[model samples]
Target: MSERDDEEREFDLKWADGAEQKEPSARARMLAARWKENPPGPVPFRADPEHVGSRRRSSWVSTAVVLGCVAAVIVLLGYINFRAPY
Candidate 1:
């Protein structure tokens, strides 16, 4: 309101809270255009020979671990229920 108040506040009210948006950079716009022109195809399976072996090994190991955990839980529950005087 006063001359001192104007000096204390220099910010404009036009874009006080709104963000200043900007267009994408040249490289980003070029990549977007290229992607639209040549969209990617469906991903291929077993693309690498090294990955194929590890992937198969991991599945087998995971299955064995899951089965072992389930068996242990069932055995523990059965032992606990049998020993309990109900």
Candidate 2:
């Protein structure tokens, strides 16, 4: 084989053997240790006061839109099924 072919084969074989394991960096280890010692507090369940009204309003709007679409489909199907033949 030529030099290039031999080099390519060596490269493929080296990667095919799988990667080597690596130790975590000092900063990563320090952060992990700190979190272990003092974990974060639980997340809040309630929405913020300013956002609460908007969230509720948007949810109601979305629900009304879905119900409107469903009602339209139902009416269209009923008219198609029961309408007189032309």
Candidate 3:
């Protein structure tokens, strides 16, 4: 074999010896241990009294606006179809 072929084989052999895996850092291990003792609890739910009424009112307004838009589109399409020569 040529020198190039020998050098290529040597490189492949060296590369095949994969890198060693590393353990978690000290901070990561500490956090894991701490959570094991006392893990997080479920999130608490909150109710806003003042905003509830406004939210319902805005929902009704939005529904009215969407319905109005649909009606306008249907009327415009009917007008277009009626005006079409074909």
Best by lDDT: 2
TM per candidate comes to 0.49, 0.44, 0.49
Which runs of model 3 end up more than 4 angstroms from their true locations? Answer: 1-44
Candidate 3 residues 43-83, lDDT tens each?
Answer: 64865778789999999999999999999999999999999
Ranking by lDDT: 2, 3, 1
CA RMSD (A), model 1 = 10.5
User: Least accurate stretch of 10 residues (summed lDDT) in model 1?
Assistant: 10-19
Residue pairs with backbone atoms closer than 3 Å in model 3 (clashes): none
lDDT of 1 by residue, 7-40 (tens): 6554443445355885788999998999899987
Candidate lDDT scores, in order, read 0.84, 0.90, 0.89
Residue 9's C-alpha lDDT in candidate 1?
A: 59
What local lDDT score does residue 44 receive in model 2, on the 0 to 100 scale?
81
State the displacement of the C-alpha of residue 63, model 1, in Å, after optimal TM-score superposition.
0.2
TM-score of 1: 0.49
Q: What clash pairs does model 2 have?
A: none
